[model samples]
Target: MTDYGNIDVEQFFTGDPIEDWLDLKRREDISTGTVDSLVQKLQTNSDGTAFQQFLSNRDVGVLDATVMDLYDYRDFIREVNSKREMKNKLSEVSTFYNDMRRLKQTDSNPAAFVLSRTDTRVKLPNREYHTVEAMGDFLAFIPHPQMQTMCLCYLKYGLRRGAVVNIDLCCVNIDDPRYRPILMNAISNFIGRYAAVRIPYIFTETSAQMMWLMVRNVATETSATTMSYFRSTTR
Candidate 1:
């Protein structure tokens, strides 16, 4: 039996290089999700014929396929796919050849030699920003104090919704005397443990006070059992 790292090539090489490579991947304990994705990519093509069928039609096994064969396949991929998709398809092909080389099934990776003419870097669309007046009007329409505070936090800190939601009460320190009673109540009921050192918070003094006031009102009004500063009453 041919020893290729941990895999026994003699037992697994069943004439189909793609099937052998996939089986090797499974033997290596690759994640099921990852293996399933690879299988889907190999079997599905826009033109009804899969990559293995394309190789078979060219009268070449994967291990014996030439660089020119890969270039032709790349062209086929480009015909119906986006530049990004073509890049991904070629990358998967290259990965398969790389594994073949590792298993000593092939001496060279022909897919690695294939090159593309298209610029594959996907450009993100430009985002439009609201004017100051527009932002004020939008904030004015949000009726809940908690939601209004959350929106203000987004505008002031440029924080994502998830980040705002995950902000624990212990993360902020509001020293305003007017809000001290509410802050004390929150601290007493706060279930989350404080870190050894103060966590670096992004909120300014005014914004922190606003958030505390909103939290205080929310805690008093709602039956939310969650200890998170941003309490949701809905199940």
Candidate 2:
């Protein structure tokens, strides 16, 4: 036998069906965090993980899954977890099977049938709406300038937390001739390190440019202060 030195073994393993599905997602440029969460959910069954117990069985391949098997899994999920969690888990499984169908690995998505059942059972409350006055009162309660600026940006732009945190110094471009009262463009790091996406924030009452300028100045000043404190402590 020929000796193969220091060859990575992972290249050959190729992972289980669940992992294989997640790998397909990664190839499509899905975020690592999102894919990892799906994998975790697939591996963690009510009794012993849906993937390991159902899809991984050689005798009962994914293509062989019927609506009854899916219903059994749904009952198992409901037994082990809350209704909300069950809905979420079933949704993930449905998405996985749907994607598998798209890949021509399966002819039907049993998970989709199960998901529809769960959706009908779950009744989530309506999302709360905050008025302008309520928002003003909340803003007045915040003490830190950086936190206030960040919150204002999020409120004004309806940005997610990840988007708000990803705003970079380069995102501030007041000198551009096309610059309106709004920041026009803000960089959000929602897609992890792969790329920075442009997100625009519109100002209805407050000056968007001024808000961004404050964000930049406060963020820089806060960073400098924190570093200075760390240096002093270290010295």
Best by lDDT: 1
Show how many residue pairs clash in every candidate, following the order shown: 0, 1
lDDT of 2 at 206: 35
Pairs that clash in candidate 2: 45-49
> Could you give candidate 1's per-residue lDDT for residues 24-77 as a string of tens digits?
888896899999989987766533457667898777787898899889999987
Give the winner by TM-score.
1
Candidate 2: Cα lDDT at 220: 43
What is the per-residue lDDT of model 2 for residues 1-235, given as tens digits with 9 covering 90 to 100? 2387677757755777566667778899788899888877765663465644755553566668878777877786677778778799899888878776776757555556545656344333222344576566555544557856776765665423222232222323223344333334441221122233332333333333344434443454444455456657954
Off by over 4 Å in 2: 1-122, 157-235
Positional deviation of 116 in candidate 1, in angstroms? 44
Worst 10 residues of 1 by lDDT: 166-175
What are the runs in model 1 whose C-alpha is more than 4 Å off?
A: 1-49, 82-155, 158-235
lDDT agreement of model 2 with the native = 0.53
